[model samples]
Target: MPRFALLLAAGLLACAAQAQATSFVMTTDALAGASVGVSESTSDLSSSFGDDKIVLAARDDAASFVASDGAIRGARLEAALRHIRERAPQLDADDRQLARAILVL
Candidate 1:
């Protein structure tokens, strides 16, 4: 009985670890139109949200959002750029620069 309990505990721990490593997905359409313009900062992206225009869909560990129609895409773009800066410091300077440029627009 003790052996069985130990095995069960191990199984439960493995399952929990697997669940924690799982990825999530999200989608939004607020920036659908301005997908072309770029913002210089995350604040710019956040301010573009008008009422319910910015819709966020979150799943597990991931989230997606769309900007409102005609809203400036710069601020939202900046956020993605900032995320790369925060999450991928190992990237080369050129890669970071490209990421920043992409985030702006």
Candidate 2:
């Protein structure tokens, strides 16, 4: 009877522990293995909505975005590229292009 009571207490504790287990909303998606326009300072990239634009861009390339319907492409790309060059001073045109290729992949 003592062994049975001890087992019952242990089972209750286990159930309580399981019920109190902490959970988190984890969303840590790392970048591709290889990509062009590599932002090496992407340690804080996760959880940032800024990178979502890149994904959208990959889905809809510049070529597909035509001005036939009178919707002109913004100069944001050029500006963003310039900003990137400034931030990653070592990232040359070639590196940027390579990173871009990786991103598009």
Candidate 3:
């Protein structure tokens, strides 16, 4: 029908106009400060703890402590938190966060 034909033609023209209105420009300006000279590996999760090696060392114990949800448990996690606070006092984290991080990392 003539009406359907007219609608199809208008839709096609609108789509074509939209396609032409869009433009893409590629540039290397963002990579100006990027340096691939030295890249650090992230495989070592213990490095995130810095000098607070106890946190990394007690990961297994922390995992066990986390498994026990009782209030009287979590001695290992507490010890790790104390070590982290003593060595790296600047870190802003709690036992729950440390437990999660220990499980994942």
Best by TM-score: 3
Off by over 4 Å in 1: 24-105
Using TM-score as the measure, what is the rank order of every candidate, best first?
Answer: 3, 2, 1
lDDT of 1 by residue, 1-60 (tens): 999999999999999877665522112244543333333332333343212121121111
Encode model 2's per-residue lDDT on 1-95: one tens digit a residue: 99999999999999877666532112122234223234433322222324555433432332233222314333544444444555556544442
Give the Cα-based TM-score of candidate 1 against the true structure. 0.26
**Candidate 1: worst-modelled 10 consecutive residues by lDDT:** 54-63
Compute the lDDT of residue 99 as modeled in candidate 3.
58
RMSD of each: 14.6, 12.1, 10.5
The C-alpha lDDT values of all candidates are 0.39, 0.42, 0.56
Error of 3 at 10 (Å): 36
Candidates in order, TM-scores: namely: 0.26, 0.28, 0.41
Per-residue accuracy of model 3 over 1-105 as CA lDDT, tens digit each: 999999999999999877665522112433332211111211222466644556666677766765765243355667876866676565555555555455555
48, model 2: CA deviation in Å?
12
lDDT of 1 at 76: 42
